[model samples]
Target chain A: MYEFLTGPMVWISFGIFFIGLIVRGVRYIRGLDWKLDRVTYGENISYGVRGAVRSILFWLFPYGTRSWRKNPWFTLWVFLMHFGILITPIFLLGHNILLKEKLGISLWTLPEAVADTMTVVVIVSVVFLILRRIALPEVRIITNWYDYVLLLIAVSPFLTGFLAYHRVADYYFWLMAHIISGHVLLIAVPLTKLSHFLLFFMTRAQLGMDYGIKRGGMKSKGMAW
Target chain B: MPEGTLCNKKTIDTKEQLQALLADKSGKEYYEQMNDLDVDRKALWGVIQKSLKSRTKTWLEICSHCGLCAESCFYYLANNRDPKQVPSYKIQETLGKLIARKADVDNAFMQKCMDWAYSKCTCCTRCGVYCPFGIDTGIMFSYLRGLLYGQGFVPWEMKIGSGMHRIFRAQMDITTEDWVDTCEWMAEEYEEDWPGLEIPVDKENADIIYTVNAREPKHYPEDIAEAAILFHVAGENWTVPSEGWEETSLAMFAGDWEAAKMQVESVYDAMDRLKPERMVVTECGHAYRATVIEGPYWAGLKTGKTPIDSLHYVEWVAEALRTGKLKIDPSKKIKEPVTYQDSCNYIRNGGLADVAREIMSYIAEDFREMTPNREHNFCCGGGGGLNGIGRYREQRNIGMKVKRDQILGTGAKLVIAPCHNCWDAIRDLEEVYKIGIRWSFLKPLLINMLEVPEHLKPKEE
Candidate 1:
């Protein structure tokens, strides 16, 4: 079970994620017809690039604009949650060791203490996100079964891995569960809302291009971009 | 509810009267218009398939349903934060569902979707600014509107207006004779001030061909007179086309691309014949957008080969002021505290907010800026052809409460809206809310403050 989880399953999930993203990205790029005459918010390419960069930087931080201020708790937790999820996968010691053992290449690793704390934060943030979906009426209306299922999928790997690392249950069973769930997540990223991780840049680029390039050199006002 | 005290009794009565005028249509007429279109799901799906470009696809996929865009919408903010009013929900309930179901939605669902797309959203694009990913809800809504329009689900006013433009070459069914007569009458009215002012019509090879909204002839002839006065004083070689004088494009608002193309082509054909070096559009927000920005694209003209240069009246006025051709009398400036409502098309879409404010500063003694002025300012709620659709009057009035509150907070006596639709929407708000404030078009205000030179002023007898 351990060999299958780390060998063919890992390759399968990685193949699905990387190839799926490439297909989606290529389709999106090929579909674009440059709207040379579309009216934009800015006057020139520099203005568009500036607005795009500003938008990216603003959204990268929590409470970046007044809109984000509406739900301060959600903003902070979600930001931290996303940060941990993204960073821990690449930098966690266990993941790096697996990479070194398998592929003979490994990135820098985070200390076990830091990795444990990040996994805990990710688990907590996922719980909060689920609570937010259930608690807020506006959010509740839009939430579907897929949303809850996706959240469960996102949280399982972190939860199981943390328990396994701390030896809270049978270590082999918990570790296997973690590896399988982690593969499920990798497969889900390109196929679900996790696609936002990649598509967000595309959305921001289109907006920046609109506000910056097509707008005839006018600077976007107060987050208008 | 806002914390402001209500205005005097006179203001309340005025508000009621204006609301009555807007909502005075018969129930029979509403029903008649509602049942005009037959729903064909397959045809509608085809329209959606054709309209799904990269931008729409990206916007649809990337939205995380975070509900962050809710606060950016005036409808959402003003209506006690209703989630249904959220821009994302509009996409989800209509286009999102359609995409999920492969555009196989039922007629009842399509009807509800059409109402949401047309009446619920103004397509102001303001919400996009606040979006974390800057997803343009306006573009998505427009694509939905285009789908509905292709299936013959357009509102009555838009259909009638587009029909008028297609048949008579104008909005509001103004005949060629009526247009010529109105121009002559406006020229005569302005001649009283300048004695020999020439409101030239159909003059070939003129420096500029000025076009106006049909409302200027039907309801607000004074706007035309003001433009004439400004043009006469500036000594511009401009002429109003006899054939394609009305510049407002209801077809564009209706999402009927073919009719929109025809409307634009009429102007292009006129410019082609007249050979004007430039086309100066009057102070109608949608007209300026459809003409200067979207006209060539819709009319199938090549990217860099537009027949004539299109300029908004705001740009023209600003340029005139800059070049000393039109001067503002600083002493004769408007004394009352004034605020400018940046029309969505002029500011958010056209990026002329700075030029508009600059022009306002030169004419008004005390220009009080609204809390969220310029591109970030709240829409007047009458854009996207909402003001023209009688069925959405109540929704429009309710949606405009945010703008009403913004104006009330400024404590300004007069509001200068640069676009006709903004002027109309703000006027309705002033009346509906009993705010007791007056509204004027920016052109008349500029005309009132403009200084005629000794050589141009009428000689005292």
Candidate 2:
């Protein structure tokens, strides 16, 4: 009975998610008269490759020795948590199973322990993010309806997953709820502001390389072979 | 090899001089200079109000304010950690108020919001990066400034700055004759550095047409000389248009988008007339960014085609170095601790700080880093025409405290600023705060440090 209910819920959510995303995506695509095209246009391949690699590195261990040394505490925390949990674990990894599980195909067993701990980290990080957004007067001043929606979006799956892990409801129902919510998030990724996952790394690397050259800091050592 | 000492003689020292300087210069008796541009205040304000009206709905509709923007802002972290000076707050003080009043409150309050908005922000769009919404307040502010500009209520400094821009499409009110004479002076100076290296003016069909801000000729002549030397070494064919070569657009800074658009048109006009394959913008960050990126989209409605892929001088030089067209001796830059100030227009707005650093490393031996770098770098308080308006004095200084701390924190003996406004404003802070740090353009440092080969060097007497 739980499986039946779960199955249709998944299908319904997927349908709504796909349709909503397609509407938004098509709107954005059609909206490109010229200016949008200009921004989208660039040295696409160089930017695309650079963007993918650093984004993955950035999400994992964000405060990894270098960033923490460079940034202020709050900034580092916000940077790591926002990118690490909300963005990386959920948004970038695409329900955490798409890329991570695929890439770790041989090491699938390793993810169980990592996954449970990461789920906890996501909840804690989201809590920090929520409190920081509310606590900081500057952040609060700029917060809008979308921000609240995003914050809820980031927190819900983790909470549902945690509940599922603990079997808060009948085991299958909770897992089904988690799976449905997770997939909906996957469909929403490219259409919403969540797409920064796709955009930020390229912007940062381009910025990093551009600044590096302009200030005469270092040439593109062309990355380690 | 820091070139210019931060002139210790502060411009407006006492409160009295500050008052005199800030006072309406035109109001002085017998001091009638130019005809007052009897700008229509009400109609202009209406345009501004209309612009605000359009933006308010969007402003309220966007900006999640994740505080990633704060990390991206140099101003926030610089001023003893004051969050209000964050790019968003600088935006909010004006646009936020307008949004609240226009949608929720009253028109009179909206009028007050317009005043606050016009006076406070510089419209440098560095914070657009951290904005998950990509709500470019710079665009919003620039739009508002354009509206305010149409009305005579634009801050006085921007009025003069944009007025100059209107006249010459440059920062200063220079003429064709002055530009020729200035280039001649640079050519003659470069002769000492690279003899017979002529900075061709209005030379048609040159492969590259290098455009410079009027500031290089008007205030810092050496900057022009540095460019000439670089061109000489690179062996690239480049020319400057005698009439429309200037690329710095204060109108862009001041929010006079029409005037800003006109400036872009003039550069494109120069390109059309000169028919250069490409244009290498001089070492002015905003000027370069404006000519290539923002100027096009913000004003591209007027121009039929996207202008050629104009590159920043830093990018050009780094490429030249990479291609071995231009060579440098790293030891030429003294071993003294030196830090680079990323102009917000370039780093945040243009996303070119890494290129700037790449260029600097080849010249300097010891380099110190600014705390928040690249896209996350702070504004030098001079961006967005803040320095242009004399009325914004105290606020500009307070805002500059962020940059002041960044430079001071580096404890570097020298700071390299690529943009003219950053150069002027940061130099002002060094003097005002008595931070005792010397500053110069990146090229000047390179020129001083680099060993121009005897054959490349100008022939000795």
Candidate 3:
């Protein structure tokens, strides 16, 4: 029964997310042709392999090897925290492990600890965001129904997962709920505003390359992979 | 003693300054303070909300609330991220109130919100790039300003900016006679090198008519001399019209469309009479953007009928060099590594980055590039009428650090900025940062690079 519930929810979310995302992506690509080019594209292109390589290295080690000494401590904290929250569960080897093994229902104790800690941090950070949005008049003024919906969507997975892990109410039912939510997020990733996760790094990398060119730097580095 | 002295230089300067102040302020405040004391809050909010609703896209949908914009903004960066100085916060505080009230916010809460956007933001679009949504918060403030403009609530300094924008239709408030006199004086000064040089006014059928910023007449008359010498040496058929010679439009910055339209129309009327092949606007960024691109539509000018060819002065000078219309003595080196400051209006609006480089190459011996240059160049501190409002001095100077760092990164000894506002703002940056990069307009450098004219070639004593 749980398997059946998981299968249909996954299919529904994957369908909506994939098609919706493609429509938005196509619209964005078409919009670029309409904007003023001077504002959009830089004037010159400095050639070649070395510049590309340097840009890639720079993106990986964004602040360089200098650690947090050069920039403010807050930047590193926010950077690490954001990366920690974003990178782990989304890319958790367990997702692949489940898909490969096909019937692993339980998290190993160590992996479970990591997931719980990360979930706590994400929930805390999101709650802080919610509080900040309410306390600040500017953010509050601009907040709309969509913004509230987005926040709820972001917070739901963690809450449901945590409840499922603690085996609240019916254990099998909550486990199925957690599986369904995870599948929904995967389908939503490419389709929703969540695609910003992918686009942000791509745009920032392009900006770095453009910045190098505008500065007349002859050599640079990068590959998106 | 009476008639002739009325046109004397110092008197003209003082009178022009007064006219600038009058048009900028217009005694709206005296009536505003009275309205505040007597009028109903409900009525005033009604007028304010009506104007706010008509805003263009810049204010309404550009910000993604990422707060990266705060890092890029001069005000926010300088203020250590005070949040109030952040462009988004400034808009949210003022426009937010009006929006809230329309959406049913209390009147008492609305007036308090007005304080931030009115006092803090100079409306420079410096942080526009950092926004994920490309929200031009500057346009938001300008829209709010337009709303405030309807409410008869311009700050004292903006009144000065608007006033200068009105009479002169330029940033400075010089009259027709004052402008004509300045041109005549500049021509006479350059006659030492080119004796036949004439600052032709209202010349019929001239190949070009060059329009200059008010700064050319007010503070840097030598720029005018340089342009005259270049024109004479190149044998270009160019003239300056006495009636509509001014190019710098503060109205573009002030968000006053009527004043801006009037400015473009006046210049067009003058250009129509001259029947020049092209009208070349001198090194002022916003002016060129206005006249060449936005002015045509703003003044209801359609092409083919009353058509006049318009090109940036940089383009004209560059084309002259490329076509061998002007011969230069390459032995005359500026002896300094010069970095170019790209004016945003010219690069982003007028699309004249290549022309800037072409003109610079003829003058500078060693031309260095400002990092993130051309269309992506950082704004000089003086845009959006920031220079007009003297009260915002600290934030404007702080805002200039973006350019200061670019100049410093080049390690160039000199910075060549073509636009008058860029020239003025960058000069302040040099002093404020103590970067020691000697700032100059492109015309002055060109004048230095040119060979002496045949008419005034040095004679044996």
Candidate 4:
């Protein structure tokens, strides 16, 4: 059962992830009508690209914006959540070894101890994120069963992986749970709010261009300082 | 990625549809009828389908409700950090739910949505600056207001305001004749000081076509005089169109897109009729936004640019000062402890924050900026037609506390508000909170400190 779960299920999940991503991305750009979305009219691609680069760069760091600086705790946790969720899955020694065996290709891998610590970090970040949803009144007001389920789905792999590594429960059983949850996460990325992972770049770029071409105007040469 | 009005060219002209949905009643009867109005569920869902484009769908779908946008909203801050006032939750309660459920909604729910969209938010767009994903609640509320107007669920004053635009091509009942006559009267009044000064009407192929808010003719004729004085002293060839002089659009404020289109079209028509080199609007925030930015989209202009290049009053003034056309007397520059009120439409939405600051250097000697000045400044709490709506007056006053605190922190005795809406809001803030600070528009301040050109100056008077 474990062999089947680890072998074929991984391939299926990866296939869905890649296919869903391309389809959603293509549809998004194609769906943007020049007439309805006013951004098309005044959008100078050179200026838009410049603006998008600047905005994304600024938002990538802690305390980059006044809004970010205003909420330091949220900033710290969000970065940690993203770090562990992304880094642990991609760079773990076990995952890399598995990838090498499957495809006869190997990349650099994180040290075993560091990778394990990151898995624990993902679990901690998830706890804080879940607490925020339950405790913060503004967050609570907009949150629903959908939000909780997404959070739960996102954190399960990290939690189960950590448990399996620490030998807290039956190792083989927990390892199976980790692999299944990890597969579910991969499939869920393009289907659910987790799409924010990629949509962030798209929306943030659109926002920057909207501000630059449509409103902010970027102190361009034409503007008489 | 999404559906929209684009598939059907026939659906593009939505002005008549909006006009038809506008309720005629006002005051008591207006409120009563609005209370009992039935939700057009089919049509509402139809709008929901159209609004679910790439931008709308993505914004609604991916807003993770992090609560980081809570402090970014003045409504949340001023309401003592009420979670309900958070920008994310406010948009979610109305537009988000509308999209999620495909508007399986009722009249009571629609009424609650209307209250939140109109009263709770001013469509200031400041929250967009703070949003991690740049999901502007202002944009969502604006779209929601459009839906609410279709359902006959708009506020009383907003309905009346849109009606005025329909009848008079102005927010008030001031007609073209009144606007032209007021310009003439101002020209006559200022002629004694600057000989042969004329408010040129319909002079084709000149430099600029100066347009103004309707309220300038109805309440403050001096604003007309002040603008004419600036142009006359600068020796620019300018004309004011008799038919389409009113530049403000209460229709845009009321979500009456049809009437709003008509309002801006009149201004566009004036520019087209005169064939001027450019258009220069008076110091009104939303008016500039309506005519220069959003209005073109409604009018179906493919370029998203106005018929001609348009400058905000502040931009023009800054250019005039920079080019040595209109000089400010250094001696007469204001010596008071003054601060500039950054109107959201002009500063945050219009990208004239630096231009406004440059203008301040010429006029104000001791300029103290608001704590979070320029694009990040808080709304003065009366934008988005909130000041006019009687039902939201209390909430409007409550919302002023943020601006009030910001002003107090600045320690500036005089607040220089460039936009008409911001100017009106500052005045109201003083009246309500007794902030003990005086407010003045840029025109009166500039006219007072301006050095009358040697040639235009009356001889030996």
> What is the Cα-based TM-score of model 1?
0.90
Docking quality level of the chain pair in candidate 4: acceptable
Q: What is the C-alpha lDDT of each candidate?
A: 0.77, 0.61, 0.60, 0.81
RMSD (CA, Å), candidate 2 to true, equals 9.7
Among the numbered candidates, top DockQ falls to: 4
Candidate 4 chain B worst ten-residue window by lDDT: B3-12
Off by over 4 Å in 1: A33-58, A61-66, A69-72, A215-223, B1-38, B302-306
Q: Which wins on DockQ, candidate 2 or candidate 4? A: 4
Against the native complex, each candidate's DockQ, computed on alpha carbons, is 0.37, 0.12, 0.06, 0.47
Model 1 per-residue lDDT tens digits across residues B362-432: 78888999978877888888989999887788889899999988998888979988788989898888778
Best model per lDDT: 4
In the range A6-121, model 4's lDDT, one tens digit per residue, is 78888899899988888778877766655555564245677667667766767877778778888899889888888889888888888888889888787789999998888777
Error (Å) of candidate 4 at residue B226 is 0.5
**Per-residue alpha-carbon lDDT of model 2 for B1-461, expressed as tens digits?**
11111111122123343244236563231112112223343554455454443223333343446665665554565555566656666666665664444434333443444455544456655555444344556656666565444433344455556656665666676778898898998788667557678889888888889888887788878778788877777788989888767777777766666667777778888888888888888877778767776566555442322366677777887788778777777656568898988876666555566688788767777788988666556778887767766555777787788788888888797988878888888889987899888988767666665556667764557
How should the candidates be ordered by TM-score, best one leading? 4, 1, 2, 3
Runs of candidate 3 with Cα error greater than 4 angstroms are A1-149, A155-172, A175-225, B1-62, B103-120, B164-171, B300-309, B429-437, B453-461
CAPRI class assigned to model 2: incorrect
